[model samples]
Target: MIDIKNVNKFYGQGDSSFHVLHDINLSISEGEFVSIMGQSGSGKSTLINIIGFLDDEFKGEYFYYNHPIHEYTRTQFSKLRNQNVGFVFQNFKLINTLTVADNVGLPLLYAGEKRKAIKEQVKDVLEAVGLPDASEKKPTNLSGGQQQRVSIARAIVTNPQFLIADEPTGALDSKTSREIMTLFKELNQKNKTTIIMVTHDEKVALQSERIIQILDGRILSDKKVNA
Candidate 1:
């Protein structure tokens, strides 16, 4: 569902330039689960940001479902992300004062869905994430894993076609991380949601169907995992 070719990203002007991505070429099919793994400053997250249409200042051609992202306007990108993409960050990014249902309904509310529809969507996503009764709880009341689950619920409430997660399990313990990863796996398999995750953990990388290894702003390798 994504095609990127000869992509390069730089920060700063001529003499003060720092290149973050180098001639990156990537293609991901719909319903695929993939991981981008690298050390700090290795450009994994940068690449994801580009793919997610959050940053389009790089030099290259990006095609999402055959539409050229480089030609899309800022408002177009915003609408694309809202309609088709979901993002999960290492930080939950939830408002402390908002209830779980409210936090999950933010995207829908922004899309101008009616209150009754928003409430139903929130309930469905929360239940899908295995948090059926979490609608009324504040984020602070939940544990780290539960909060992350709520974050996941929030992301999928719109039923996005693509899910981009940046260090999604970074804040959780091993068991909790595994649980979260398994939840992602189920989402990919059952819902056919394409997932592109950025992570430093080999174990987490292994959970994906494809692993992309990056270093020094370039892709070192891209390979599939055995069942």
Candidate 2:
């Protein structure tokens, strides 16, 4: 449901300009699981930011389900992002002060959903993420894996069109990472949730249906996994 054509990103201006992405051309269908693999400063993050509607200061065309994303105004872009995309981060990004249910319900709360509905939706997502009993607990009391699960629950609670997972497994142990990947796969397969994940680990990338490797601000390779 995403299409990007001839996209280029730059920082600074004039003679001091630094190009971050080089003629990026990519398309991702609905429900596809794709991973972006890159080292530090390879511009993978920039590309995903554009895809996720988090960055609009770039040159090129982006079409989301045939809607020209580049033509949206700031308010429209922000609304579109809120309505369509969910994000998971390496650091879990949870608030220690809030209950797990409260954390998971933030997006719905921001969207003006009622507390009763938000509570039900939060419960469903927590159950889906294997954290059915975590609603009353604080994030600080959870293990890293449990915290990540809470983050995933928060992301999916909105029933967003797609998910942007930036280094979701970067802070976990190998076994925990595997469990998280398994949860992601279940979401993709059962819920038809499209996922665009950025990761540096090859093993993590391999778990996705497709892998796109970036090097020096350009796409190095795009290939499907054997499985």
Q: Where in model 2 is the C-alpha error above 4 Å?
A: none
Kindly report which residue stretches of model 1 are placed more than 4 angstroms away from their true locations once superposed: none
The best candidate by lDDT is 2
Note the Cα lDDT for every prediction shown. Answer: 0.93, 0.94
- Give per-residue CA lDDT, model 2, range 109-225, as digits (tens): 888788887788898899999999999999999999999999999989888999999999999999999999999999999999999999999999999999999999999999999
> Worst 10-residue stretch by lDDT in candidate 1?
109-118
For candidate 1, the TM-score is 0.97
The residue pairs that clash in candidate 2, if any, are none
Candidate 2's TM-score reads: 0.97
